[model samples]
Target: MPLPTDTYRALTQSVSAELASLRASTPDVMKAFGDLGRAAMADGALDKKTKELIALALGVAAHCDPCIAFHTQALAKLGATRQEIDETLGVTVYMGGGPSAMYAASAIKAFDEAAGATRG
Candidate 1:
């Protein structure tokens, strides 16, 4: 099932604040992390959209709720379709097993809710 829209919205807001605090409190570390993330997601052998999907799958495998929400929102903004997400979830489930399957569902729910929030 998809996450409640309000919950997804709250998670996004909370994460933004947390990330901001991390940047303020640990500028050096956060800058390094941010630079690596930017480089990793930049176009090359794998495009930005594909990297986002991979990140989403990893988030599911790791059972990180905030990561899931953040990546899902990024994927949506990058024009990822439902079909692509479904296929990515299939691979994530296969590689990560039963627990990942459950988290994949949660990721999808969060994505749907986030997408709605964006539209509104």
Candidate 2:
């Protein structure tokens, strides 16, 4: 279920409209959440870019597709390179992520099964 990067643009736009409606329905909660986002993202010890990178890593690790789309879209707007994205995902995997689980499975299978025979 790989999505094209451009799909993120559409996803962000669609989610923005839904968020507006959500705010209308849950004004207090939405306002609080928005406030939290703004406060957290404001630059202090870390810049916004770093925060977004962290978010991207967390999103990938958590398997949150929408989070990935939103963060990648943000990173793109912030001038993130392919290297940055790749490194971020690399860190995410290093930190024990869904990607790590996938690779770990393959590693175990490879270890258990040689070219043609199974091992103990």
- Per TM-score, the best of the predicted structures is 1
How many backbone clashes can be found in candidate 2?
0
lDDT by residue (6-32, candidate 2, tens digit) is 455555567787789889999999999
> Best by lDDT, which number?
1
Q: Would you give me the overall lDDT of model 1?
A: 0.87
TM-score result, candidate 1: 0.88
Which 10-residue window of candidate 2 scores lowest in summed lDDT? Answer: 111-120
lDDT of 1 by residue, 48-106 (tens): 99999999999999988888988999988888888889899999999999999999888
lDDT of 2 at 21: 82
